[model samples]
Target chain A: MDRFERQHILSGFGIESQQKLQNAKVLCIGAGGLGCPILLYLAAAGVGKIGIMDGDVISLSNLNRQVLFGENDLGKPKASVAADYLRNKYSDLEIVEIPEFITTANALEIMSDFDLIIDGTDNFSTRYLVNDGCFLLKKPLVFGAIYEHEGQILVFNSAKAGGTNYRDLYPNPPAATEIPNCNETGVLGVLPGMIGVMMATEVIKVLTGYAESLENKILFFNSLNYQTYTIDFNSNPELKKLIPDTFEAFRAKDYSLSCETIPSVDWDFALSQQNSDSIIVDIREASEMPKLEREEVLYLPMSKLLKESKSLLAAGEVYLFCQSGIRSLKAVTELQKVLPGKSIYSIKGGIAAFLSKQEESNTYGN
Target chain B: METKEQKISVRAFGMIAEKIGSAQIQLIGISTIDELRESLFDQFPDLKNMKFSIAINKQLASGNAPIPADSEIALLPPFSGG
Candidate 1:
């Protein structure tokens, strides 16, 4: 009875729904940043059964936001350590640890056992693998991601009412280099924690049948501005391409969407756009381009655009640039969806290419 | 002979970015994985022994790629957040 004491947070759902949560099984992918918070809250919430899977080991850097382990846990496989932490910390919760990396080869078998899966994985290759596996298994997915100061959360799987998955939003992935890692551009320590907590909140919402949860909608947040925005996305026509009847068919399909995407030209265009007064607005952080030697332009990071629409530059022919053009493309896509007919182009090579292009153009022009 | 101080960029991603001070650093050092790590740890003490991977020019590299002057080197940690 003491275990059920002030845990009245779930009491509002009535015991039946809470029992649903307790009986539910969730398989978490990745034991890193997002996984830590989701696991912590789910275990604390007394989810009857939890499954943890990851191939990576604990690193010294993970201690900051992972918040799951101390110095002693370093160098150990994340799945084992994370499961051990949850099992010991919340002795009441039942936990299973799959200490293997979830690859395309084993994704189906691994995800089939769980009622729901959380995509805590960091890279696109794994995200696609997780998405395809969940789609095949027809299990609901709780998704979350963090950038420097921004984050995203969505839930999907046709089984759950109002649940829409990752593919509904991004039909394809960006080229690996198009998007830099958090290492390339530092992320606020609390950004992923905030997003991870939001994801955990979504899991509770789905399990307890909170009708107003973020279903079929992508929630975006800017930590710097403390602003949040939600875009209603549905079963897109594009997602239909992901449906595969057999494993081989699935394997053949270009699940590596980022690799297959059209090579972008942000840098070439940004340089030209800026040199010719084409309204060069950097969709990345201003700090990112501290030494940026652009002539005439504007600077509005993606985080800024997420909350405040492009109403300011809702003018003619705006050129958006980011680190690798992916963010700008994403920003432009989101913006164009909302403010249709606005002219916007993504700078392909980001600043690097643009600088080179500028130099080339100047060399010839001179 | 003067050892040219190659200004290579080391990009830190995910949790690894947080440990290595700012996300991107144009580190000035003799281009080599060992020297790069040495210089990085020399500046950011907390990152010592922090397990992470390095990528050069967007391609994953062994820890021994010669860091040429003004090359792009990225530091990656296991990112669990999708």
Candidate 2:
């Protein structure tokens, strides 16, 4: 019996389907966390040709979940490390590396060559980029995300075989601040380890044409309870309408080219205005992260601001904020509906950039 | 049926902690902090955490934990996302 046949029978995804996996080409975006496991499983499963794209270097922080790297690999670009790691692990597999960030400028060019795409990005901007790019190209996207203990996965644009895309679930992109990254909160090392593995499973199934792919559905996993549930999705006309009739439009209306567009404030000007007369209102939720420090700051999670704001601030100048500065804008919009003349502006980049501006203090206790 | 502010304690983490100083916050609330916070989240729905855990009077509680005015509450961020 071959190593592939661990089961009693000759069943292993079989030989013909195996050949399809051996011949298929796949592209994986991001080479950290989820990307590492995703690439590892795919190569070992014998994906004939695989393109790994990333511009990020391995950080000391990445070692926790990106098991593919070692202490000596820190600071090296992830794409470089992952490519070499995959090749060494499976010398027979065709492992290729596009040593650059996937951006709107090159989404189509980079994705057009692959049979499938696995989005391992940690932020919404990148997820949106991958969603739009894959939709435009009509390629399959193997998407995964880990937030604390939970993870979500979706297979979009499945080989022109009538699969749904990202927009099927979220019809429109919410402001970026609404979703903070692991950096702002944090991820348990084991969390991504599990989610990323499941993602690789989906990819292998799609590659071998074995088992079933999660098409037009979003799968949710609760690592705590170890339960898996899925929500059905429809091909929303809102998204199908996104399919540009020509590659020119796909390239012209570029997305995914930028790794992240952080919302930033006019810090120099805003900080100057932080005085006794003005109150800087942090509109982020209690747990929504990247907490900044300042004296003039008023800690009112957006929830509180909307409720008793009138009583709390009978008369005052209020500036709103959240993680990315996006939510602050929304809060400002909402506040205007009630207190028409109240002054409110979102802190640019919310607290992320705020802390980035301030000298690095001790990282918050985990 | 309802009274004014009662003295209580609260806990927080992640960016929330980074914003508010680290310490068991001794404060006042009418009911429970969860109730207070949920009303906040209603206006700002994005903060809904699948893993938003809480502790009431030093014991972990669900989203529905009832607060009897000024009861201590802790807003915890997800622990597994590390």
The TM-score values for the models, in the order shown, are 0.57, 0.60
- Scored by lDDT, model 2 comes in at 0.65
lDDT of 2 at A247: 66
> Looking at candidate 1, what TM-score does chain B attain?
0.82
Query: What class would a CAPRI assessor give candidate 1's docking?
Result: incorrect
For this target, which candidate reaches the highest lDDT against the unseen true structure? Answer: 1
Global CA lDDT computed for model 1: 0.68
Interface RMSD, every prediction, one decimal place: 11.2, 9.4
Name the candidate that leads on DockQ: 1
Candidate 2 structure quality by residue, lDDT tens digits, A61-141:
677788888889875767888898888877667888886666566788888888999998765556777777887777888
Instruction: Report DockQ per prediction, comma-separated.
Output: 0.10, 0.05
Candidate 1, residues A1-366: lDDT per residue as tens digits? 546445555446656666787898899998777888899988887788899997666666677778787789776778999998888887777899987666566688778788989988776656777777777777888888877776767788835534355655555554453455553456655777888889888888877776567777656566877866555545755565766657776656544324333333445444555444357777765435323555566777777775666454545667776643456656666676666676767665455445555556888994
